[model samples]
Target: MNSETWQNLLHLESRDIVSNWFEKIHNRKLSARRAKEIISSARQGREYFRSASTASFAVRPLLAFYGVASLCRSLTLLHRWDAGEEGLKQGHGLETVAWSATLSGDLHLALASIYKLRIRTCGGLFSDLVTVTNSRTVWHVYDRAVPMPVDNKKQKLGQELCFLDILERLPDIGNTVSGGGNQKWIRLDDFIYSSEFGAEISVHGTPDHPVCIEYADAGFDLSKRNDPYNSSAEITVLKADENLFRKYLPQLIDTRVIRTMGGQPSPHLVSKFPQGSWFSQISITYMVSFIIGMLARYFPTHWSALMGGEKGDAIWPQINAAQMYIETALPELILEIVGNSIFDNKEL
Candidate 1:
């Protein structure tokens, strides 16, 4: 999650570490040709990521976005190797729908304009990535302070949304989204399950954060606590009937499983908006990076105006944090998916 922890798995500077990872992929018993394709794509992705490390902020988004795209291709090759080289070559599956002008000399209005920047999915590499990953874009919103999941009936392709919608859902830059201070990710310490005793969990987070449990196709449920739980309270008990417990336990365990940079695998103690439909962490990073990269590459004047403080002083910080986090987090995510696909079965 952090740079130091991520570096242990992704050593861009050292060929040996990367080779060690490739060796694991090779051991997956994939055909020689498929293994070669996966490794080659992964190597290209790593190169882009490594190159982005030294680039200036002005151009870092472009490099980082390509890095992520390449890594995504590598993942597609791994999961959908049957698609073959040609199938994987689908172009970027996303397109910008509109860009609204907001330079009316009002800082707040300019900051709000990020929401006007919109994009939608068409069919291409990004779409293939989504398909292989088994994820879809959704309209995730807060309802009465709880994150609500949009029904599958409402889930549709080509769902256009403003950049702010995506940015607000990202935990890394949640604080910077329109300068609002809401925590989107909370620490999940432990979840204990017992056939006889039912389940109890230890969730550590501030009282202000949304730390609710969702289960049995029901909505968010603040755990049954005699006293209000806060950061100081480490555990909360949940009692479920045996029939429901047996039905949902497997799903619960499956979803919470998380792998680290190391060989050891662990289950997350708390669920992140458990069972809620939201963009995968990778998709958010990829899309946000694409937006920044577009501004840098296609709208040089606008990018310069924001970067040079000609406009958007209020909006600048969020953009800066987004770029910084993407640079730091993308590789970790790429490797996490790689490791899960080839090394183990944990997921994001």
Candidate 2:
């Protein structure tokens, strides 16, 4: 792709769009221009994102996405790792697990919008990486040719931040964690908070501009996620593309945190995101919907064909089962167990 194409892909005015949305809806000061640059890029990525079919199959994208980012220092990859195909596939619990999962794209967008990265590709030298995105320029390194880490970071070129590229590591976070080790997220913020829960995202400097990026909390909840496979699996992302804050997330909506505590051994412990799960599920589902909808339009009809021995007439049962697992049953179980634990701990 040419620079023009790359511009179209990466320079979408999503920030402006989202900022404007907030300005209009909440009457808050915001920059809609940021969202504008990445909308098209996000759409383009959707093409590859939804190509993933099953829960277990989605892990590749999820892990690979984050694996690419080194700045995401603390990640519970193993805590969230899926151990079995049954857990990855047969268990209808991934959607629940992914509720807190965040995408790196959101963080990247925030980083990129806040700070721009200059990508350069050179032969043999990692600093001069052979970036294929746009700049069709190849060259010898200004500095002596030095081997670079297999990772995507062009350290030689002074590219330090690692928020955005990480999402490319895993396809579906829930799959990776509960449903068998996949990674995914929708609504960019979901990615941010999930990736850096209780952790601070420290941004040191910017180009030409002397501004520093600060967040009260780098974490955004994955309550809303776009899941398209099953309607019951459908969950919406909170503040999907809305211009939240250039610096800090405004209100203290300890929703999912509450939910997390709810499922804890003690109620006093208090979950972090009571409402985040729903929001994460919704947004993630929305993203999945967009991907599935887009792909369904182009994919052969055979792709939609049911492989199950069960009759299509019994689809309602499947739908109900999905809802029970994703919506009602799972939530009830989570709350029944963790809610009390959270409350008890909080009291203590």
Candidate 3:
């Protein structure tokens, strides 16, 4: 189909109609008891994290991790409705329908958590969901348009091409594809590979040859002190960007890249912590060590400034030894501040 036809078919009206139909069908399958169970589970998970916030620093990380895991489980259960035989009978493949529902559920839960955390971070997480969903949606349409292929590889390649075709047309929807616009687009691979933690993952692709998947208004510059907390800075993909994103969809689905970018490896896997022990304990310890190292390296001048003069040579050795001791101990006061500011999502 031509770009105009595709656009017409996937316009706002069509989206609303299909979305409403899906919602009604999905809602009809949800029993009141099931809804109650989901709500109760989510509430309990939130409460666990809330209580953990007040607990000792060593314990909060464990609680937060479990709380996030529980929330994920709850979302998965909620999306189970979309994968039912009913949807399959309606011409949607079980996997495709289920995956779309899962992404929607994840976005919903992430938004709720962002609000509850009172931290405006996680915009990258939000954009990632949108990119995946849009790419999958375009691919689904293309698959339906084409004849079925017996070979799995051919089917996959065809789907990728279909996804790219849609992305090339995104500029029609107001996305800035060529000239630099207000919206900043970043390749998914670039964003992940360049991240502090993500850099450790062995992934192919460079800053120039990034995966096709792109996120608009990603707000990647976390260095700005005020940006993380700016609620007004919402992350979203314009209809145009969605159209343009198809160009890179195939590269993004490459098995090697997919494997590398799949999930955040548990920090516990590399730590010296004993098996089954609280992972957050080690996390907080590392965080403490990082902070102490920073302070020891940078605070001497600040200390002298606060004291109105530099320390005399006679006291230098004593001061250095005290700094070393403080670095090793990583006092509770500093740990508390770090935990609150970074982990708890509170403003620094």
Report the number of the highest-TM-score candidate. 1
lDDT of 2 by residue, 54-161 (tens): 233223223222211110100111011222112222211112111112212443232222111112212221221112111211111122111111222221332222
CA lDDT, every model vs. true structure: 0.54, 0.23, 0.26
Instruction: State the lDDT at 242 in candidate 1.
Output: 44
TM-score of each: 0.66, 0.19, 0.25
Ranking by TM-score: 1, 3, 2
Kindly report which residue stretches of model 2 are placed more than 4 angstroms away from their true locations once superposed.
1-174, 177-285, 307-348
Clashes of 3: 8
Off-target runs (Cα >4 Å) in candidate 1 are 1-33, 100-112, 135-156, 174-176, 180-185, 191-218, 224-277, 343-348
Candidate 1's residue-wise lDDT over 8-106, tens digit each? 534533445444554564443455565566667767777777777788777777887887787777767666635556776467777887554533346
Per-residue accuracy of model 3 over 150-195 as CA lDDT, tens digit each: 1112111101111112121221112332223332222221111211
True-structure RMSD, every candidate:
8.1, 23.3, 23.2
Clashing residue pairs found in predicted model 3: 164-246, 167-243, 167-244, 167-246, 170-240, 170-243, 170-244, 212-248
